[model samples]
Target: MKKIREIESLLGLPSPSNISVWWNMGSLLGFILVLQLVTGFLLSFHYTADLYCTFNSIIHIMRDVPGGWFLRSMHANGASFFFLLMYIHIGRGIYYQSYMMQPRTWMVGVTIFLVSMGTAFLGYVLPWGQMSYWGATVITNLMSAIPYFGTNLVEWVWGGFSVGQPTLNRFYSLHFLLPFVLSVLVMLHLVFLHEKGSTNPLGSLHHVAKIPFHPYFTIKDIVGVVLLSFIMLGIVFFGPNLFTDPENFIEANPMMTPVHIQPEWYFLYAYAILRSIPSKLGGVLALVFAVTYLYFFPVTMRMNVLPMAYSPISQFFFWQFVVVFGLLTWLGACPVEDPYVNIAPYLTVMYFALPILMQVSNSIWYKLIIS
Candidate 1:
């Protein structure tokens, strides 16, 4: 009875009444995490980490295991959904200045984002398909951009001159291990979130009513999860390979190459940024800076109010930032040729400019509101 009551109290934690569907995204992400864990575990039973066996094992899973295809599809598509929710969760945090109000929570969340990407990269290499082999080759080779020790670093990572069985074994080990690390970090994130309390869209909500997590927000999260399930289920059942690359259908060939060597869609924006630069080392650093920029958000500018409350000009720029992001994502999907090659560098400049423009807007608004 005592333990049960403690659990109920945790679930009944208080929150602001003004939160919208955007707030439910975190809970939806939690649901996807659980799905990934379950499916990944089951898929492990039939998988082999050996380079020669990896592709054949995946094919066997699809053909021999009773429900293996479903499991594999769910795991793959679940990753897609996981990233989709994370982008929304992170974007909402930025828009509402949640990072400013709950700095520790934001920090943990961003760390989890980085870890999740590492985990996904490890998982992508496991299929050992054409794209998997070349993608692994391309990404691992990026380490050679380091000044003096770059060649040694690449050798250390490859466990040889090139990606092979040793590399596959290491990636498989890390892919299995990182998800558990992610779970622990997620617990820390929730701990900080609960300590600081949730951020409301209007900034501070001292004047608003507070309500319990159970019955109200729990019910809201359930609704969000159900709606999300419909879309995920449709893709899993009908079009399992919709997001997969056709090039991956062929077994990995060291001698042959695909016409295009693109990554999964979520990484496309960063990939675009990586390709925009003229110098290899500079491009690698730019990719690093793109994600690391989030770490500096709290220190860049101090704002007393949320982005929405900051000023009309800030809000206007915010929407422009969103459109620019979409444009970058679109450019990422297109071939790195002709007009796109010229256009990407310009968009890359604008992408970095958005944050500086944001801080400028915040400065003007602070002066106007205070004076």
Candidate 2:
């Protein structure tokens, strides 16, 4: 009884009544992170990171180990859904102007996203599959666009002139190492969240609007987890290969290239940004910019009011922003030819134009328009 009361003192809060279903994304992300760590550890036991043994080892796991395929599928699909929920969590934060009050929390969140991307990319290469090979080749080559020592840096990364055994070993080591790092970051994220506290759907941080964390949020989070479990289990079982490429099943051949070569779905948007530009250096810079754009949010956030309550013009534009993001995701999956080839540049333009739109909208609201 005493321990329960002590824990309650740590967790209980007067939270906002207006916080809606979207606020559940953070809870979902936490669940997914723990899921990834567990499944990944199990999968790693049978995984081999060598050039010759890696692909066959995966096959061995699938054939030999009981329920190994199920575990592997869960890990792969879990990564995809983690990114999916994270995007929603970030979108929700933007919607409620959580960034304004908790900029440090926002910064840590962005760092986690970037680190998670790195972790995912490293893990993707461990299977020693075709897409894994070429994907690593294509991305690491981007660093070679740097001015003087770029080629040297690339060689160091790959442990040679190319992506081969040493490269695979390094990626395997980091893939195992980074999740532990992320676990720490996740802890820090929670600390910041608990400190600054959560933003309400109404964008109010009012003390009077606060509520206890246990009975209310704990219950809501449980419901969210149950719902997420159903959807993810369906994906892991029925459509295991849905998000993956057929080429990945084949062994990697440096001499051969697929008609269409792309990263996994989560990376496609950035891949699209990279391909949209003509110059190699230009594409690399744009790719870096696209991913790191959110890093500047603290400096760029000159918000006049909560986004939902701001100008209807901006609200309409926000929906347009969502549409543009979706279009970019779709367009990225399309071939690098014809209409998509032409459409990509324009979409990229609109993609980047969004931050500027938010800044301008906030300026207008605070300055001339509202007054």
Number of the top TM-score candidate:
1
TM-score of predicted structure 2 = 0.96
| lDDT comparing candidate 1 with the true structure | 0.88
For lDDT, the strongest prediction is 1
Clashes of 2: 5
Backbone clashes, each candidate: 0, 5
Please provide, for model 2 over 75-108, each residue's C-alpha lDDT reduced to its tens digit, 9 standing for 90 to 100: 9899999999998888777766687878889999
**Model 1 — TM-score against the truth?**
0.97
**Whole-model lDDT values for every prediction:** 0.88, 0.85
Candidate 2 to native Cα RMSD, angstroms:
1.7
Name the 10 consecutive residues with the lowest summed lDDT in model 1. Answer: 301-310
Residues 1-371, candidate 1, lDDT per residue (tens digit)?
Answer: 99999889778778888889899889998999989999999999999998788999999999999999999999999999999999999988878878788888988999999999999999999999999999999998999999999999999999999999889999998998899999999999999988857878876635357788889988888989999999999999999999998988899999998888988888888888888999999999998998888998878767554356647877777778777777887787889798998988888888888877876887788788878
Clashing pairs in 1: none
